[model samples]
Target: MDQPIWLTFIVAFILMNVLLVGMAYMTLFERKVLAAMQDRVGPNRSGRFGLLQPLADAVKLLGKEDLIPKHADKIIFYFAPLVIFVTAIVRVAVIPFGNQIEIGGQPVALFAADLNVGALFLLAFGSLGVYGIILGAYASANRYSLLGGLRAAAQVVSYEIILGLSLVGVFLLSGSLSVRQIMLQQSAELQVGPLTMPNWFILSQPLAFVLFMIAAVAETNRAPFDMPEAESELISGFHTEYSGFRFSFYFLGEYINMIIVSLFAATLFLGGVDGPGADRYWGLGVLWLVLKVTVFLFFYIWLRGTLPRFRYDQLMGIAWKVLLPLVLLNIIVTAFIRLIGNGQIF
Candidate 1:
């Protein structure tokens, strides 16, 4: 049964606020992790252990002057950041954070909408966000911004293929594209001789898992893969001329993308919301999802602190020459194995 209209609205409202707050603290989380890795204190002055740092940063950005280049295309420049930010937030609509739970004698689903083609929906919307970068760069009327936008277009085009292919194995193994269906399938236990374990796709599709992580990192333009915004070469890339709240929109969009991608990965491969006892308690399921996302978030921060940025050529080459082939191989192998298991081929 469908949830009440009012209930759905409430869930979406709560989810949106949670994501916004999470995106803000993600900055603080990254900084603290990087500081620990670099043997320095980070953001301890704002409020206890700098817990209030995100608020401080928000205030500072709000007070900064908004600037637009005199020669810039005002219309495109005005809407470009909105494109990125809105797409990032909308991508989370289909992600199932937990199973249905009872509320006031009625059952309520945990997601905004249960789309049958959730995976494709994510990929399609994710692809749209690049346009914001491209348009922002072009409208800025700056050579550096143009170069950054070009780099972004090329890099995203290359990695997006690998990212899509990497998920082929997961889709094959689960036999469904609905995020909730995939998570439910993973909740089953697999008996391998004397061993018993949750049947997460990560166990059966390790190659796909690795490929997905790499492609995901590139897709989000983080660390070594962040060629589009390479400060040294392109001077902050597409948004070079953006300032104040407009600039904050791009920054927030990136962090929100990271969170959404992390959550999506947890759902697809980590038995999202399926930890011990989650079956009985929906709240536990939500907690498990949060824990899984936290691990991925930490990995993202660790990469930034540990690895140097890749050269533009190396970034593009790895996506095309390396990840592309591996993901294809993983899909082929997965399909063959499934066929054998089903006795469809000798």
Candidate 2:
């Protein structure tokens, strides 16, 4: 039986809400983890161990005065946040968060829309995110914001290419664009003496994972490569003209993008939603998936806590000179391996 049209809308709405909530608190989680890394208490004042901080922040944003600079283009300034927010929310469709259980004898896919070209869709949307920043920066009429937007556009353009190329190995092997298909493919070959590996993409494609991780970090403008939104230099970057919930939307979009990147990394390379006892117990898959995603998220937070921001020139050089070439070479090797496996001479 096919899912009803209304159900699809409902599911999309619910998942978007869930994504928003998760993104909101993900910031707190990052702070807490980073604090532990540095031997300091992250946040304990708002609520128990800062559990309520995200909520409190939400309240503050709602009650705060909305501001737009006198020089800013009010129309585009207003539109930018919505663009970023909507674009970020739409990409969650292809991700399978858990297993599907039979209900009423209908087999509903665990994910929203497991498109054949899911990975490519992610790349497209990720690049689109840069436009939100670009428009916001241009509309603000602030020199710093404009500069930040330019950096973001350039950074995302270069790194996103590297990011997309990094996943070509998975595309090559799975020969399917569906994310679930990729996970299923990894599951078949995961056996060892006494260890049962979840169908993680990491084992076969470590280089892809590494290159993808580095490019993802830069693409999201996270630490070490976060030249776009460097607080000291850009005065909070492209959204400087934005205030109140508008700024929150941009921040929320950034955080959501971060989670999306982490989830993609987990699903593509870390063998998404798989874990010990995956064969016998269905629940273990979720646990294993969470563990894998947490590892990536921890790495994200750790880098922020440990590394200093990179200069613009150095950041660009690393992406162009180092990451691009490495990812290209990885794809070359992967192609040759695939060709040899298929008994193709070239």
Cα lDDT of model 1 by residue, 61-172, tens digit: 9999999999999999999999999999998889998878888879998998889999989999888989889999999999999999999899888888988999999999
How many residue pairs collide in each prediction? 0, 1
Best by lDDT: 1
Residue pair clashes in candidate 2: 200-271
Candidate 2 structure quality by residue, lDDT tens digits, 83-146 = 8877888888887765565558865555787788888888889889888899999999999999
Ten contiguous residues with the weakest lDDT in model 1: 1-10
Off by over 4 Å in 2: 191-199, 279-283
Candidate 1 residues lying further than 4 Å off, grouped into runs, are: none
TM-score of 2: 0.94
Give candidate 2's root-mean-square deviation (CA, Å): 2.0
Q: What is the TM-score of each candidate against the true structure?
A: 0.99, 0.94
